[model samples]
Target: MTKGNLAIVLHAHLPYVRSEEPGSLEEDWFFQALVECYLPLLETLEEASTAKDQTPKITIGLSPTLLSLLEDQVLKNRFEEWVSIRLELLNKLETNCTAAALDLKGHLKRQLKSWKSCKGDLIGRFKKLQTLEIIDILTCAATHGYLPLLRENPEAVRAQLKTAVREHQRLFTNAPLGIWLPECAYYEGLDDLMSESGLRYAVLDGHGLLNADPRPRYGLYAPICTRRGVAFFGRDSESTLPVWSARDGYPGNPNYREFHRDLGWDLSIENLKKIGIKEKRPLGIKLFKISSQNTSLEDKQEYDPQAAKESVEKDAESYLKDRKKQLIKLEKSMKIEPLLIAPFDAELFGHWWFEGPKFLSHLFIKAKREGVKLITLKDALQLTPQIQLCNPSPSSWGQGGFHNYWLDKSNAWIVHEWSKAGREMVSICSGGLIEESNIKIIKQAGRELLLSQSSDWSFILKAETTTELARERINLHLKRFWILINAIKDNKNITEKIIDEIEKEDCIFPLISPIDWKKKI
Candidate 1:
């Protein structure tokens, strides 16, 4: 048997961003993710799974909103066009570069070729992996609603949980046994709802387990069961730091591609427009490396793809060696088998850090050779026969390790709107509005309310990266919700034009009932 078990969990999520107009900036979030993150990650895993590769175990959380976006035909088609245009953009730069950009240009050509090979079917590839048991797929809250903040509105919490499970079933045709709570945030009493949703396990930060009621005897090395019987796995920070940390992580290496310095930002709007990309946005063509820290964007050196590729192999081997050493030390110190749970945002791989997907592929190969067993959280529990029951403290992986990221002065007003919307929505559906003539508008109203409750808007508000758009999203949904509620209550006509528009834009949860909001407990 291996000395210890290592569970690598990747949480893939993005708030629903659909657009009817051409060239909306927010729409690029989905397309960029598809071309960069989702497609490459899927291809890497497919290649890894082709033979009897028992070492490539993983658990991935697919939030309902992201799953819906991946399954949408419109987005799929747009992704094909987006990558095609960018490939043309790269073709122009291949010969015109200042010798500094040759490697960057060649790198993009290879990436686009891989994208073409994928043919834009990321979700189906993910499903195929699940069927083969190569990876375990986990569910997340509907719209990724921040659950701790919504605890007061239990019905809203239940709705998020219920809707997520339902959607997961609809997609994979099997209920998920694990979940990645939005933000890895956990508060007391959430497990009860998970039990109801049929989720057997979830992952949280280390402090969540360290501060548990019984003070877990094995600490982060083992799983803990809540009073509600749901299993909670705590993330291992030591295992996570090498990849996620900016100061010390692989992403900050001078050889890796820099995330922020995109050529799109340097190009003229007129030049960009001529290329069919009208918006002055990230064209997913970054041409430089981190180079040297304290170096400005203009001062950075050109990226050499060959060097970065070599670094990926070395880094993956170093990471595997370190984890094996740590696991051995931990197992000896504890006098028992230790489990290392490393969970990270899936976007970090190919989207933020260009070599990320390749790093993962190499890690699996290196771990297998070094005898470091790769396992999922479910597999960990099966090995450890005894689990201690405990109550975790209220915590998150956010900036202060609390709810402050979603509740600070910048976004505090969102909590009030969310609570009010929940109360009002419950009143409408439970008050007999579900009768024959008006259920359509009421259901649409619930969709708006649910979308507004998304944790992404509040996060964007606090980050201030796109505040106006975030504010507009809140306003748009709240206004539409009230319009439907008032019309139905006053026995007035619900406008078809309004219904038609929102259904086109914010259409998620094709089967959500407004009554999911009525639970008082």
Candidate 2:
């Protein structure tokens, strides 16, 4: 008999980084994630689905902004060109890293083949896997607006939810039943908004559930239902620590590829500019291994594919063994079957941890042989419909497990901007302007307001990486927002040319409804 269930959730997200210039830093961010993470992940899932017995069951949350990028034909063409350029560069890369270069080339060629096989329609391939019951897809907020911070204007929060739900349905052919709330953040009464958007469940950090109004009897082993009818699954640290902890995790293994040492940083500026890189930045051509935890970047050893493959197998087995032992112990203490939830950022696989996809492949194969029940969050809910009702505590997965990370000294200023813009959006949307030009302005203004509210800029400000870019993005969106709001209010004749330019730049959430911002009585 199965001891318990394991739910592996991967939340995929990226800020709206679409740019007009190819090889721009922002564009590179998206392209690197696609080449390293998304494509490899798709291939892994497709391969796992063909297993004769016990196909892998996983939960994947695709943020609406990410979905929009995936569907953009222009970006797709750019991505193809981006890969071709890298392949050409690899051919001329003459160094002692020949083995590492060859391995990377092989992986990239396979990924390119997979991309071509699907004709670059990754969304469709993921949808097909969902249809096959190999994976369950969850939708996130339209721009991943931090809901707790947006709570002052409930309509602002509503627009985020409604817009996300509409976009998910538009692309996936069905409404998303669950959401990976931005930053795994929650606040009082947020459940009501989720229910209004037709979301049935969400996942939160462990404390959000463990410290609920009435603490859950099963702790983090089972999901709890909120009074508003939405269910919540808490992250299980026991299952996640082994994978996420840098000091203790499998990704830190010496045989794994080093993340920081890349060819882009080592290559001369002249060589980089040949591939359109104007500055010294990561070109994603990593060939070094950790070698030793204390080793310097220059002293790091070359990555060995064979040793890394061996490590993946060893770690996968150990992880499964640990889960089995934990479940067996929990089975004796609980009357209900225990469910272990492991949620991570999807980029961690292949992108952050080069062998992460291979690790997952080994994990699924081991899980089947070891008789461990691997499942999706949806499957876990069906397995236990009669869940405890509890009011989850206000929480986030950020530092301090509260709102401080997004509200700290570096980023506190943006909160007021979000609130002020949100209030204006509600007023203009509720004003019932019937003029065609005004309605058009209102819709575009709504998009800007939503974009400005993305948690990414604030996050970048707090993290202190790319702060200038983050500040520029926030100011850009808010500036555009106020400009359009003024056009609607002042009855100014804004040129169609100006509106088209803004639309072309930040075009996303085509089905966004300004009426979602209307105050509810």
Best prediction by TM-score = 2
Pairs with backbone N, CA or C atoms under 3 Å apart (clashes), candidate 1: none
For candidate 2, give the lDDT: 0.91
Alpha-carbon lDDT, every model:
0.84, 0.91
* Least accurate 10 contiguous residues by lDDT in model 1: 95-104
Once all C-alphas are superposed, what RMSD does model 1 give against the true structure?
2.0
Total clashes in model 1, counting residue pairs 3 or more apart in sequence or in different chains: 0
lDDT of 1 by residue, 168-278 (tens): 988889988889999989988888888988988999998989988989988899899987889999989999999998668888889988888887897899988887667
lDDT of 2 by residue, 264-336 (tens): 8998999898878999999888888988789999999988888999999999999999999999999999999
Tell me how candidate 1 scores on lDDT: 0.84
Q: Model 1 misses residue 407 by how many Å? A: 0.6
Instruction: List candidate 2 segments past 4 Å from native.
Output: none
